[model samples]
Target chain A: MGIEFQNVNKTYPDGTVAVDQFSLHVPSHTSTVLLGSSGCGKTTLLRMVNRMVDPSSGAVLIDDEDVAGVEPVALRRRIGYVMQNSGLLPHRRVIDNIATVSRLNGVAKAAAHRRAHELMETVGLDSALAQRYPGQLSGGQQQRVGVARGLAADPNILLMDEPFGAVDPLVRLELQRELTRIQSELHKTIIFVTHDIDEALTLGDQIVVLKKGGEVAQIGTPQQIVESPADDFVAQFLGLDSARRTLSAAPRDDGGWFVSDAQGRPLGVVDSLPQHPGQNA
Target chain B: MAWILDHLPRILELSLAHLLLAAPAIAAAFLVAVPIAWAANRVRPLREIVVSGTGLLYAVPSLPLFIVLPIILGTGVRDTLNVIVALTIFGLALMVRSAADALDSVDGGVRLASTAVGYSAALRFFTVELPLAGPALLAGLRVVSVSTISLVSVSAVLGVQSLGSLFTDGFERGIVPSIVAGIAFTAVLALLLDLLLVAAGRLTMPWVKGGRR
Candidate 1:
């Protein structure tokens, strides 16, 4: 149900160490984002969850089982991943692209197509687009299809590597909001990777900041990350407006900050941020 | 012109033979070329070897290649099979080059996405790679079709009769109509074949045609 990385390290064949003994746990029904600059190993870390790129040392466990021992295809099928470029197969119809994972899982053609059409609707696409190929869609629409495809198999965990990085700013916001809505409803555990601090703050339930040398700069909720950074590296990496970020850390009546939803419903009282925060806590 | 109209059935028969010879050669070339092209695209070292090897095949004169095969295979020179052999060699070289170019041109993103979506290498080849490369392959096939028609005429040198023989006979007897008929028939057939290829390309590659409404 959750993903755990225990002292995982990745040294490329060229002997460059991208991830150095990194370890973390993403609890079920949460969105954990890996935020960093390019080459900080955020993407590599995400790929390790599904064994797209194997770690040189240590273990990646999904649902308490080491992924190394699982069949790569079966492991991947249970974890949905989205890349920056919505790598839609150019030759397939939009519907067929959405059904890729389901079909891979041995779903019959009729059932797979039916599920694909349903997912297209869930992702805010017109059913008419189902018959069209990926090339016919705009960049934003393509990313929507990518998201739809990722959710096709109902995986317990979703991994996205800058999924909206290629779309226009306006469309990117739309995708972010849609993802938020979907996460609220589906409660799928997600690990999103992005270099943009704004995207990190906007989408992350728990933000893991990676520094240039693949070190853990910080890990916290968006509010905690912005308001009370662990260090200068975290503060710089977050790049939030210092004054606004400080609002949540201002002294409170109960000697603890009262956390609230945007609608002002009190969620909890926190003396200090949890070492690892989960979404909608 | 009067004689051409008078013997339209014979003209039609000649046209049929031309189609029969060229179509099969193009089809055979297409079948052989795709695997060669796929190999060329996948293996970097093999790419040069395959390309140069196919290019060398292309460089060989059609008449000589055709002439040599029958002797090497111990088949008689006058057989239609020899003509098929010659046209296939000519068509295949073009096909290998064109198919390789087409496969190479497939967008890298598409291939990556296919892999991420759980398509194996073979599935990617058949479903994604081949379909996306359809237009290029068709373009190669078009060229092969045209080339086959032109090269198949050389069968006359081996003592088999074709439109080339009609031209030879007409020239020998000073009959201008027969020469004109041969020229017109071959030209018309090539034009029709190309048009058909264009249609097939459009149907197979609706995406390439800008995803027409």
Candidate 2:
């Protein structure tokens, strides 16, 4: 299901405006990433969908239905939420953790466990790990269980708040790939929150680059944002002006061309040139 | 040693009486403290009031509490019921605070996750929060158990019959062995109760065993 945020505003009692006048349309069956650094209110915007944080003003709607009309608990049960640090219960075994929402929804014990075993496999976790507590698993394995638990309820919308932020880069890459594969098979409307530009680029079909107070710096495909940033803040946040993002190509002795960063660090080699050089011209 | 052998049956009787007094108070304190601790955990102002207010109950001298409870409860000073009630009050004083701290030790992330996964507040408390707080709660109960066992001896000052009578009689008769024996048996009882708590913790909280994490 698609989600819409209409002029949402969130202000803390202490007078901090966490989100202000934010509006967006998250298309169904697509991954929409809200990308920004900390304190940018990206997470606050994502949480508004499930009513984890009710807006101080404006409304959040799911499939043209205003979420305010729905009970928060009922609304949340149908929305899958995955957070950073895995957040798996320390005292619960992996199977029970995965079966948590299913059981809460009143699925019988044997059926819930059966579905939990299936979800474990869906998330690429070994069935052998099902009986172990979350503490006994590795960080990546625990995150796999977190993903499994998120998918256990089989909700239409999945909210991920930096779901892979705590793992090592290699594990994060693997998890990202796994999520992409899962999204391909199951086209849930996914609202992903992250600070990493590369992660947003890799996973998001539509990326919403946010500024402080959840201000929209840019909203476009990753290519559009990379090729033309909306403003200096978007450019700087994406490191477009930095050497890390700027690449230089040098002709290699072989037929391939060597691509390197501005600092002469090798990025990779392009095997073949465009069929027609300067085709735009 | 000779006196203990001669009065072995008497010592056994007193020990049984002592167990009877301590066990019910300890159990009642635990049952009472859990709900109060849960209430205290829910609100900030209430936490301060409940924890500190109950804590003051410990400062009421046991002999006076034993003596005063008769008038309040309409029981005689020497009634076993009066001592048990007094000890329950004392146990609550320690237990309420420990239970609150135990609940506080549960991970905030886990609590949030539990709610996000659709657990109702009451179900979350019983299933997730309470079980997660088990180890610390068990630790607190161990302290309350040992202290309650030792504190039962204080009832003897009110003319109630318990193993503590051995101390009073030994002092009157100038028999050091009787006093030493009473102390030994009290320590041994505390040790046995502590071990039982540990065993119960092991049985119920399997996740805490096997050096996991």
Candidate 3:
């Protein structure tokens, strides 16, 4: 259930070093997020767990077994992968799309469909939509189907690559909340890759902030990174120096305190200050 | 008009002969071209070679191909097999390019998703790639079907029996009605086959019809 990347390195055929000496142990039943901007190799590190991209120089072990010894297809079957754009099969109906992995693993058609129906309910999709094609569904609904498909085989390790990146902001927030709800119930080992800082803070129990070439810029809980960035790069990446992070409180005529950013944009109005402000105990 | 009525039975016979030749050639061309197209689509070097090579094949005059195939296939010049083989070659020339384009039209995201979900390369091609490419492939097959039906008439120049024979015989005896009948029948046959391909596409690809997204 736990995944360990032992100094893994990936250099593309075109001489681009996407990942370099990346090592991390993703604890079982926890959500570990790899957070970085584009070209930071966050996705490459996530892919090594399932052998989608084999590491050029080091080993990736799942539950203490090196993945290199396992056949790529067999290894992939046991690992659930969800990608951006809700990569559902356009030709298949929602039920069949969710049932894809179960069928591939040789489950009976009747049982797979039965499980797919259950997963549809689990993902908050209506059973009435099960017979419709993916193209006929909204983007948010399609992503729900993608999540259902990823969980179809009941995989312990789920890799999600910007899984909610393609939807609208409102839908994305809803989906993020749904994932939180699902994870609480399932407790799967999830390795999620994303560039959005807020999303990383919201979902990650352990956040790995990656720099270029898969360098670990910082690795900690959201509070740890926000409170004490390891360096200036981490501080800047998290917008600690920006107006949004430099908030000030002003007395309002209504006796409430107005909290605003350095740019004077009102964030909110607080009824009262904390009783023990700035006190550690 | 009287001449067509007088030779109604003969016209019917020639039409049957025409279907026999064109139908098999169309089916054979599709079966052969898909694998070749898949290979071309997968490899860069093979794609260039196949595109240019098939272009040259298409450029070869059909009369000469009808005559020359007997020497290569070791069949008699007048045999129906020669015409069928010639039509199949012509169909392949067009079909290989179309099939390659059709396969290319499939979405890259969908293809990657299939692999991520544990489909093997071969299984993905038949299940994901091929079905997603269905509408485009059906369009290509329509072009091939119409052209193959029309080109079967060219074999009349090589003395092979088909609907084309009506054209030759009518011209030789100065019968205008026979030539007119031949053109009409060939047009009608092409239209019928094109409609069949469209219907088959609609039946198999239900996802495309009335899809909201």
Candidate 4:
């Protein structure tokens, strides 16, 4: 596992349990999403990995090593974190914002700027925006800059807390697609938190459905989750008809492809498949 | 009219000296107050102590401060040190308070963003926190400069002779035009100082103006 929570529990000073004995594993080089409504403790769980908020009890491990042992600031640098609002420093230009982590680690000023420039290109932002401050950028553009900044330090893991939540729907979709592309190319272990089910289905390699008070309602791939929900909560949480949605995963290939039953064994050709010449229907 | 004509050259010379006196006093007060304010803002314990101490210092009449300084720092505490000390104490409390408020009001998100990006406490304060707090700090400084000009005439009571000294002379001699000239010069200087502050604020805090637009 790239990151794992071992019996972690957190109760606020007011005696409200934000997260209960939560334990889960995120596989290396894959995106594991924490999907829930507000107050589900998804955000609280994400913050524990970097020790921004310490767990009341239990351990957070990165590659089986306890994150508690590492200095919070040092641990944070090794893990990229993106908040809902993008959280760009208004006083810093695009290039400087991207270079913030590198500069903090004492990278030569010129080298940091160069790295920022390169990352800006990688994220598909115009290099010309490099000199502009955060206030000058659009919401989508700011989020792009935030992603580039997160990746600038080249951390092995990235944590996102409703990263696209603040943007309008159109911009939100664009950023989500961009993030998916970044994940595919980089293959960093990612923990994405979102309230939107569509966002979870689209982004998660493995989805962790969190119940209120931080219990794991369910954990599985999209197909496994929809097809074989762990409990009534999962069914209700994901809404009804999840099984049909899971079954719809098979691609609509022509008679070149055939449908199969639960087993890998082929049953029959799909009549709904698009027709192809020189092939048996 | 003949007497006024004869004294014009001396009046100009004295006026120049008074300008000289007020300018450095204001500059020195700002120099001392800004860092104190910045420091007070950075350290919590110091903030209350420094602000309260400067407040107490400000309440001590400027005439007594000037008079007592020569006795404590030794007699002949004329020119720069005397004027600077008076203005520095006079303005310090307000500057520190302003700076602390400004720093406190800095957007919480900016600080969090800086921390998440791995910026050290010092780097974040200097680059992000301080810049964002620029408008408030400048406003504080404007208050300090204006206060300095108004309080500077108190030095005239020590016979140090600035614009206030002219007022003192006019009051003692009961000459109406001299009092008029003193008030006129001081008012004009206050207005000019205020304008310069606004201009400086504009230049340094473009983000504020840009945000408003």
Candidate 5:
């Protein structure tokens, strides 16, 4: 397991249990999404891995080593984190922000800057904007800078907390695709947190659906989630009612699945199913 | 204007003294106030105490403060230390509040991002927080500088010679020409200092104007 939670719990000082008895094994080298609605403790769970929010009970282990034993600053330098608003430092130039983790890792200034330039290119940012401060960049560009900064030191794991939730629909799609492309090359163990089920379906290798009380409602593949929901809550959450679940998928001449609802309305197409074995494999 | 040329040597001397006295006082104030302001920004009660305390310092009448400085500091009554001490007090009063406000104005999201990205407390304070607070702090510095320049003249009443000495010497001899020269010189000096500060701010903060955002 890349990261494992052994019955972890978190309660705020004011007595709010942000996360309660959460346990999961996130496999290495794949994107595992902790999907939930607001206040479902998805963020709290994600922060625990980096020790930003220490669990109140039990432990969070990375590569079987409990995170609590590590110095927070050192531990954080080894884990890349991105947030919804592209939480970039306003004072630093794009290059400096990207070089941040590398500098913290004891990389020399010139080498860190060189690596930052390369990372900017890796995240699809134009190196021409390297000298400009964060305020000078557009929302999309800033988010790209955030991604570039996250990947600078090249840590084994990356955490994304609502990374694309704030952007426009068009930009969001572009970033999602860009992340997919990056993941194909990097193969880094990524723990992505999102409320959007569609996003989790598109990106996750394994999906953990969280309930309001911070309990795991279901943990399965996207196909498992859509096809056989654990209960009414999971079925309703994915919009997979009894009627829709009855609908079947068949091969299309053009090389995708023709999926329809009970009323034969085209629900969604399965362009490819490197997904469920029962569906096509 | 003719008096300006005739008294150019004296004008230069007083101007140098004026600058010499104000520079150290202003620098001292900046060094002291920044930490106080930063502390105020972080601690809620400190914010109230520091800001209110500084506000009261600004309300202090300059002449009395100058007269009281030697007694408080155990220095010569007419020593230049009196003027320097008084200006330093006024500078700290104005700047501490401004610096605190500057730090507060930095984006919360940005700060959290800094922490998330593995910035140590000290690194984040110096790199992310302080630089972002620059524009507001610079504005505060500009105000402190111009006000300090004008207030330095008020200390001349205590017989600590400065550019304001021109006023005393002119008044004693009934030389209206010398008095006009002093006023003119003071205005020119304040204007020049203000412009220098503005230029420094522009030079330091390139993101304020050049970017297309």
Candidate 6:
């Protein structure tokens, strides 16, 4: 089910404001990315769903029920959360790690492990690795196991906080695609928090572009945000200087400079815009 | 070496006593220190203070602690329990801090992930935090075990028959063989215990063998 935040605010005891009067809705069965720079409180906002961080004021609701009213441990068991560096338990074998939530909820060991083995294939990992410890896996493999663990319990809401931030660029891209494929089939409500705008554009169905102090600078689909920035701040944050980008229909003979990707496949159409002070479109 | 061979049977008896004295103390200490360390880790403000307080206890001369324990615990002066209690105090002193330090050594990322994955506080401690803390905790136990083995001889000064009696009997009668045998056996015992702990650590934490293949 979808999650809704109503005027949530978080102020640490040391007087630093992390999130201030923030509100957003994460629609069900879609990836809604919370995108911003550091100190934007995106992680804090994400953690509030699992009650890892309690908001100072207002309510976070899941399917019309206030999250604050649910027991935190129970709430967390029903939600899946992932973070950067694949946070797998070092002491646990891959299957055991994936089956952690199931085992915690009292699933029999053999049955839980069977589910974990199935999840391995679902996450594109070899079943042979099930008995191996997390320390024996590569970074990409570890991230896959982390995602599998998140999915093992079959939760409807999955919260990923920069889960691929530590992997190589090629591995990161592969994982991003993996996630998209998984989401297409699973249709879980996903709240993805990330600092990279490129990742936000690639993954988010609706990108919540947050500003400092946890304010929403803009929120739109990737295409909408790229086509029409809400303000100079939004444009600047996206590195969209007037000179670098345009939607013009110029040079129709060449189809306005068809943009080819690394493998020379047509990726997008681009047209130059008026120049910015630093560069040109 | 010759003295040890000549008194092999007596040597074996004292060694057994020493083993009984040290092993139970270290085991008791490990059980008690783990919870203390876990508690201390949670109370950040008191973590260093608690660690320091325990460290101070470790420094209290073992001989005095062993000698005075009958007064405090109301046991017979020669009771082996006194030595066990004294060494346990020392073990806790050293190990509480070691356990805390080991727990602290765990990766913050992993610890946070453990919580995020719906692990109850207690479950996380056993399944994630404690296992991850294994290498350092084993290292601490290594130190505690070796020291406890060596300290068992000190109890002989309080009329408890142990390896330390070799030193006493040898010194009083001006007999060098007993002193020599005690020194040799104690060193051998300490080495054996250290190796056992190391083997146990390797067995329990096979993942720490090396980097990922």
Best by DockQ: 3
lDDT of 5 by residue, B18-114 (tens): 8888888888888888899888877897788878898789998888888888888998878888778889999998899888899898888888888
Query: What's the interface RMS deviation of candidate 6?
Result: 1.4
For A95-166, candidate 3 gives per-residue lDDT tens digits of 999999999999999999999999999999999999999989999999999999999999999999999999
Which candidate achieves the best TM-score against the true structure? Answer: 2
* Per-residue accuracy of model 4 over B68-178 as CA lDDT, tens digit each: 787776657565576766677677766767777888888887788677666667777788888888888888878887788778777887778777877889899997777
Instruction: Kindly list the per-residue Cα lDDT of model 4 for residues A1-281, writing each as its tens digit.
Output: 58999999999999999998999999999999999999999999999988878999999999989988998777778788888778988767789889888887778999999999999988889998887877888888888998998898998999898989989999888888988888889999999999988788889999999999998888999888877889988887777444323332155545344565444555556556555887888
Q: Give the range of the ten consecutive residues with the poorest summed lDDT in model 4 chain B.
A: B204-213
B1-213 per-residue lDDT for model 3 (tens digits): 888888889988888888888999998888888899999988987897996687578888888888899999999988889888999998899888888899999999999888887899999999999998899888888888999999999888778677888899989999888899999989988998899988999999999994785
Give the least accurate 10-residue stretch of model 6 chain B, judged by summed lDDT: B204-213
C-alpha RMSD values across all candidates: 6.2, 1.6, 1.8, 6.2, 3.4, 4.5
Write out the backbone clash pairs for model 2: none
Where is the poorest 10-residue window by lDDT in model 6 chain A? A242-251
Q: What is the C-alpha lDDT of each candidate?
A: 0.83, 0.91, 0.91, 0.81, 0.88, 0.89
- Write down the lDDT that model 5 would get: 0.88
Candidates ranked by DockQ, best first? 3, 6, 2, 5, 1, 4
Give candidate 5's iRMS in Å, 1 decimal: 1.7
* Model 2 ranges off by over 4 Å: A275-281, B210-213
| Poorly placed runs, candidate 1 (over 4 Å) | A241-281, B210-213
Over the stretch B1-213, how does candidate 1's per-residue lDDT look in tens digits?
899999888778777877777788889899999998888888988887887687677788767876788887688887777778778877777889899999998988777666665677787789888998898888889888988887777776666776666677778899999988888888888889899889988887777776633
For every candidate, the chain B TM-score is 0.93, 0.96, 0.96, 0.86, 0.95, 0.96
lDDT of 5 at A265: 74
- Candidate 3 chain A has its poorest 10 consecutive residues by lDDT at A272-281
How far does residue B116 in candidate 3 sit from its true spot (Å)? Answer: 0.9
Instruction: Sort the candidates on lDDT, descending order.
Output: 3, 2, 6, 5, 1, 4
